[model samples]
Target: MHSRFLRLAVAAGASLGGLAASQAATIGLMAPLSGPQALVGQDQVDGFMLALEQLGGKLGGQPASVLKEDDQLKPEIGQQIVRKFIDKDKVDAIVGLSFSNVLMGSLPRLAESGTVAIATNAGPSPLAGASCKPNVFSVAWQNDGAAEAMGKFAQDRGVKRVVLMAPNYQAGKDMLAGFKRFYKGEVVDEAYTQVNQPDYAAELAQLQSAKADAAFVFYPGGMGVNFVKQMSQAGLLPKLPLYSVFTVDGTTLPSLRDAAAGTISGAMWDAALDTPENKKFVAAFEAKYKRTPSEYAATAFDAANLLDTALRKLGGAAGDAKALAAAVKAAGSEFKSVRGPFRFNNNNLPVQNYYAFQAVKEGGKVVMKPLGTPLKEHADAYHAQCALKSLP
Candidate 1:
């Protein structure tokens, strides 16, 4: 009996010791890795991995583990991945929620679980408004942010009649609505094309018939590549000032090349941003990847840094989800972001500067030239609808 009691005591002490020692942070990152937007997903992953490498394969001076899954750009698949991450893997945080639809599908579970969710890409309007969760934060811009910048740019340029186009989806609708929020001019037409549509010939024909002074679009990933190429092929670019958001960026610019020349884009961050942090990030990214980093990549990089700062504050432990979320929010104000003037709004969406970039030729090479900043320290329009008050 004495021996048995001693053994039991030893076991209890061991359990207590184990409880005292915190485990390394585990991150479950989901993205569309095998679909039309494969490049987009890969860029996000690569950017995060680069930051991890630079941080010595650790976050906040402690070891970290990353579980990457492919959503295939399907909402059901994304939901399944989220379930595995939360229920089985028991991840400390979830990152890279891909597109708006996929993010929406995973949101219910994230809210219920109280897990920290840092979206590097999608920032759906629904989540930004009344449905905002304390644990959910968008490191990227709000869904309509870039479009709104483009709208203001067009309005400033005195583009009287404009045609708008985007994929027929929640984000697409939000983008057009955001554009209209700033541009009070007449909209010749609003075209909602099928998601991932291969051709834009018919849309171009209609756009020409409308005789609009400018065209604003929101296609992303492969869709952007196809649309810009098709529009250029149809001889509608130079004749119609093409103002866009996410339609002629780094992801599509390489493929669009000279075809995308003269195209103007509005975004929160670009390689041309003249900041010390952005310059270092862009140089390191290009040296490592041998290609230009897109806004998606930049956002993911920022997400990783956000985690680094938050986790560092928590001593590399993320077991307390609410504490981690609050740490992340506080870190938002403290960390030096590659994108300028980044902070989490009351609803946890980014408040950052938005700029206009024009694709122009310089020294026989087409590059995205920084035209000017259209919006400064811009906050999304939906934060007032969120229930959460300011964090003290």
Candidate 2:
């Protein structure tokens, strides 16, 4: 009997140690890696890694472990990966989701599990409004905010007629709606192309016939490169002004260097954002990766920093989900972001500044020059609909 009691005590102690080890705080990154949008996903990963390095591998003064899972850019795959992260890996939080569809599919799981998800990209309106969940937060601007800023800029520039195009998806629809919200001009043609359509020859031909004053689009990833290259080849680049959002950011800039020149885009942050955090991030990213970080990367970096801020406030304690949630809510209160002052709206989306940027070449490198600053402290139109009061 005495020997059996001693053996049981030893077994229990070993099990307890394993449980404690498994409970160590970790952040999971779910992103596409094996699809056309992999470049965007990779950028997000790089940005998150840079943030982790800056923090010396610690968040909230406690050492953190990062677990990465490939979502494959498919909604079903994304859902599976998120489930694995929550169930198998037992990650305390999730960050750096890159696609709108993926975010939508994974949100329900995150909400049900009470797992905090800090989106580095993809702010679908449904998540920001009707389907909003307290556990889901965004470091990136809402899908429509940047495009709306561009629409307003186009209107201000006296663009009377414009051709609009986007992929046939939730984000694409949201982007078109956003542009139309502020454009107040004739949409000579509103085209919804297949999500992965590579050739824009048909659409470009249509735009030529329409002879619109300008063209606005929301193509990202390889679609942006293909469309811009074809647009330039089809002789439209010089004929009509091309205004876009999410079409000329960091991921596509290098590939679209010459083709994207003279284009105008609207965004919350550019690689050239003039701020200390941005400067450091850009320098570090270029130094380590040999390329300028894109807006996706910038947002991922912000997400990581936001996570770090939340963790620090918690003093490295683990397992208090409610307290961690509160800490996350307190994140933007003190941290200065690359895009300027930002705070979470009632829907848990960011309130940030948006800028109009014209793509220009400087010393053979593509750069964005600030054309106008639209919102010094912008609040989304949906904020009033949220019942949550502002953070004190």
Candidate 3:
């Protein structure tokens, strides 16, 4: 069943690519188009395409064209795509990077070229730390923020002996480290899985034996769907509570369906968030795509909105890439984000709310419902380390 779902995801992604090719502002998207992680890349593409449609096929009053490429979730492929976008397509900006390793490979090139790189995902800690650059910005939460929120929730709920799991990558390590920063309870076991491992049967077996009260994981894209399905099949869904970050969202929720019911995750946005901006976005998204928008969709929407707002400030003349980049950095809080009141930190990462969310079947669809708010008006710990005082 999981294999069939993955195949269908790839097919859908190919169809979306065909649709994007028919349109004309040449926005470049680099993601794992083929591999174990393709489902996540597909989700990022879907969310970003939806944002483009919402903008009426124009950014800064010019017709939009998207140049989509398959990164295959490999760093080398990611680097190649950035070169292709910059050298060949001359894309105005780049967006929708799903993995940290890919971003690490691509960011330096984008930064050195002074090209705008608005990440719809992949907020690795290094980008928010010493390696921070002016040309790159993230529409997503910093790698550690969501996990820290989950950890805080676990502490508040008095969960002891939590099991931890994540892909062995930069963002994964950062996520676990951030969780530990807030969660002081005993971690029964800490397991690092291969980045693209398809099956989790052995890991699930070990987890059952460990008898942890709760589990925290940072499996994104296809891994999240596979892990949750195997956990349900293993009968661990109800027996042991599971808490996760970036595991159960728009991308994986549809594939998991009822299997994801009762699973808890943490994030800044959900489909059911009741706010004026979110309502408009959710309603339009569902009306157009006949599916509920995930947090990925919201973030992608913000990315497009940010670009549009920035270009508008520049009077729709995007000829000077350097001027546009500076304009975007200066045009703060112009776009109405789905998450309420989001702003860039000194590191060019987001300072936003973190909410604890649970998967619940709402009107026959699995939707993430916010349970408790964790960080209100939160700033990442690394913000104080940044020396920039004047607005970017």
Candidate 1, residue 33: Cα displacement in angstroms equals 1.1
Task: Give the whole-model CA lDDT for all candidates, comma-separated.
Answer: 0.83, 0.79, 0.77
- Runs off by more than 4 Å, candidate 1: 1-23
1-392: candidate 2 lDDT, tens digit per residue: 11110000000000112323433445567777655677888888888888888888767666655666777767887787777767875666777665898788877888899877788888888887777777778889889999889999999889999999999988999899988988899999999999879888889999999979999999988889999999999989999999998889889988988888999999999987888878888999999999888898888888878877886787666356666777877887667687778988888889889899999889978788988786666777666666666686
TM-score for each candidate, following the candidate numbering: 0.93, 0.92, 0.90
Greater lDDT among 2 and 3 belongs to: 2
Better of 1 and 3 by lDDT: 1
What does the lDDT read for residue 263 in candidate 3? 92
Report the lDDT of model 1 for residue 261: 93
Question: What is the TM-score (0 to 1) of candidate 2?
Answer: 0.92
Query: For candidate 3, lDDT tens digit of each residue in 1-392?
Result: 11110000100122224534334355666667787676666656666677778778777666666656787777887787777667765666677765788888887898888777777777888888878887777878788999999999999999988999999999899889888888999999999999878899999999999988999999987889899999999999999998998788877887999999999998888887878998988888888878777777788778777887887787666667777767666654667888887888888888889999899889987777889888786777776655554373
Model 3: CA > 4 A from native: 1-24, 362-365, 387-392
Who wins the lDDT comparison?
A: 1
Backbone collision tally, model 3: 5
Highest-TM-score candidate = 1
